[model samples]
Target: MPSTPLFSTYRQGENRVTSSMLAVFERVGLSVTETILARASGESTLETVVFTNQHSTGKGTVPDARIAADFTYLFEVKTARNAIQDPEQLTGHLQLLDEESGKKTSKRFLFVLTPDPVRPQIVEDLADMRVVWFNFAALHDAITEVLGDALSAPSERDRFLLRELQALFEAEGLISHDDVVVVAAGIAHAEYLENSAYICQPDRFFRPGLTHLGFYAGGAIQPQIARIHTLESRVLFTYAEADLRKTQGRNKARIGEVIRWALDTEVREEGEEYMVFLLSGPEDADTVRLSAPLVNDKVASSGRPWAWTMSQGYTSLVALTRPGVSRTSDLKQA
Candidate 1:
């Protein structure tokens, strides 16, 4: 059966998957297990924080990748300066995910890759894996309709993104994104095609998934925060490890500075209303590792210092993402 086309990427980090937005999930302070990356990131779930800088998030459950959520679809996100030359990459991603997850939880996994002109083998491999596939060109017209016709120049956030995309393209000597691609494995539904069939996209793409199973209730996560940008919706920075570090370094300190400042200033001050402080690491050890220092810093800054430690192995991470510094209830409710 031919699938209907769906999804449109306007820019690097700007795509909306749902219609009924109770509030922007981007603004809310999202936590996986207990760590607080989002809150530390200025305002919780601020698109500005993620888009402007390379901010890492930890999901309540996921392996290998730190900032991923436990969802129905599992896929690798392959990004390059040149468009994908092979679909076999997805197979490797599957193996990595297998190691990270330790258990094959989903029946499907996918790869929502980028850099235009998709290689045909990418789709051919999908046939081999029984994984449905989608490519960059399919989305080109829709994406262009949203991003290309704009009279104004791209935003500072987007300009940086365009440059990054260009860099990725050039890294492989690709001349243009017109040749980029996004492939999906494990998805019988189309990522940009039929919403009913596909649940998630490569870019950590998500809409409110009430009908979708196994994904977190992101909308219910935080109510106080306001979205400055979208969630992992259409972020430009979506790769893992070195990719994350590279992107962070590009705007790391700047973004970190803001997050640090916010935790010290705002959340730390939100005082004793049973407000949660989330944190997490890869292993019970990693969680302990990041949490110990982070939690201690909050106490010490609050004039009540303490000590701590951590372990190893990081499949995924999540914490309430609280601010490091803390203080007495000097402020009142809003």
Candidate 2:
């Protein structure tokens, strides 16, 4: 087990992770730091925030030797999702960033890191350019990708520390979004595959941090999963009801389209309520086909393949990719 005494404190639950992140960025060098910053801010912000201002000479071009620009990145890490609703917390952070306007700060950003799969409405509605919202799973992916590129270089120490940082995040369960919901998509499988949307009763409880959606059809689980559209934002709509119950998750017009689509598909009847999951668009990369379709092949005492009877089941990405995992029974919840 990897452990560090500097990050073993409880001053703030997320402070340990935040401190560890800064420490790793400081030790691992500029590439990893700039990659994460570029992700949180924007790719075009690389020259403005992370690098020195280049000057043009009379002959050709010249790069500044000393790269010094006061760019500040403040992180607010949340292990849970509820704290994002605190208006005072976000307002205070904005005030802190505003105070730097008079200083020599070329660029400043307040990066909010949460475990939520989707950006909360409160954070999304903030009318500030300094605020950048990102989730932990994305952060892990960005770091892992940058480090992968760095592996070809001679920076062994950098790779070792960064790998430790990745391990620390995993140990804290910040990026462990392997859990998936395998639901029976009987009649609406094609509709969902085409529209990139899924609807169910508002009361249907899915575990927090469920990463993927696996459709079960044709007596076997679908080879692909809606991984890219992993619960982007969910909105609750009551058909034939004038008043909307929860309308802050996604765009109102888009919600209306989904409601109309549900009606066309007969998934929601008149005066019925449904929660529509806004999946990613039907692009080639939106869903991932597994190595092989998971089918019910296990034999029972009666010398026949056991039948799958559940409308829904839980599994993990690890289990889906594991060898010899052919039956739904092998997909134990992680």
Tens-digit per-residue lDDT, 119-222, candidate 2: 66688778777778877766776766666765435277777877787788788877655567878877646867767777766657777666567788777787
Give the Å shift of residue 272 in candidate 1: 91
Residue 23 of model 1, lDDT score: 18
- Identify the leading candidate in terms of lDDT: 2
lDDT of 1 by residue, 98-188 (tens): 6655544433344353432323345554664524343322222222332353553344554443344334334443322221011122322
Estimated TM-score per prediction?
0.22, 0.58
The lDDT of each candidate is 0.28, 0.66
The regions of model 1 sitting more than 4 angstroms off are 1-68, 71-89, 102-108, 112-119, 128-155, 163-334
Model 1 weakest 10-residue run by lDDT:
309-318
